[model samples]
Target: MKEHKTTPTQEKVLEGMDKVYENLIEFKKKANSDLVVMENGKIIRIKPSTL
Candidate 1:
């Protein structure tokens, strides 16, 4: 298998995405809300506390 290198811009984008995801989870947990997602063509609601 070949290895792929990520550029600096790619790294920054990934880091930003991670931060946004973390914030979303924190907000949901604090508000006692479920995180809505789609899996296997079905919509699912998961509690952040479960994370």
Candidate 2:
């Protein structure tokens, strides 16, 4: 099987996502409520339980 590696941009994005995930976890613990985020110009609410 061929091995694949992440490019610099992909690595950067992954790192950012990791930070976001951590922040979300903390936010959920403190806020005890759903998270609100804007995606594709639409406002979406994500339940902490769903995460």
Candidate 3:
């Protein structure tokens, strides 16, 4: 097996994703409805029940 190294940019992006996941977990605990977000001018909805 070989070792792998994460680049600085990849590290930053992973950190950001971790934060977003944490926030979503917290939001799910306190939210009773679905969450909506706009991506590329399109509205995407995520159901809290699925989370």
Candidate 4:
């Protein structure tokens, strides 16, 4: 089987996604932040508030 190595940029992008998912899983209603999500390495706008 052939394996494809991940680039640093791609790894960073995946890491950010993991962080967001983990935060959501451990999330509490009282804890939230003004987080901005990036689209293709560019910040589009601030994300909506979490529950």
- For each of the candidates, give the backbone clash count: 0, 0, 0, 0
RMSD of each: 1.1, 4.5, 5.1, 6.7
Which candidate's lDDT is highest? Answer: 1
lDDT of each: 0.95, 0.89, 0.86, 0.68
By descending lDDT, how would the candidates be arranged? 1, 2, 3, 4
Ranking by TM-score: 1, 2, 3, 4
Q: For candidate 3, write residues 10-38 as lDDT tens digits.
A: 99999999999889877875876777889
Predicted structure 4: lDDT: 0.68
* Model 2: lDDT to the true structure: 0.89
Q: List the residue pairs that clash in candidate 3.
A: none
Residue 49 local lDDT, model 3: 74
**What TM-scores do the predictions have?**
0.86, 0.61, 0.58, 0.48
Selected candidate, larger TM-score, 1 vs 4: 1
- The digit string of per-residue lDDT tens for model 2 on 1-51 reads 999998999999999999999997888968879888999999998887777
CA deviation > 4 Å runs, candidate 1: none
lDDT of 2 at 10: 98
TM-score of model number 3: 0.58
* Maximum-TM-score candidate: 1
Q: Give one digit per residue, the lDDT tens place, for model 1 in 1-51.
A: 999999999999999999999999999999999999999999999987896
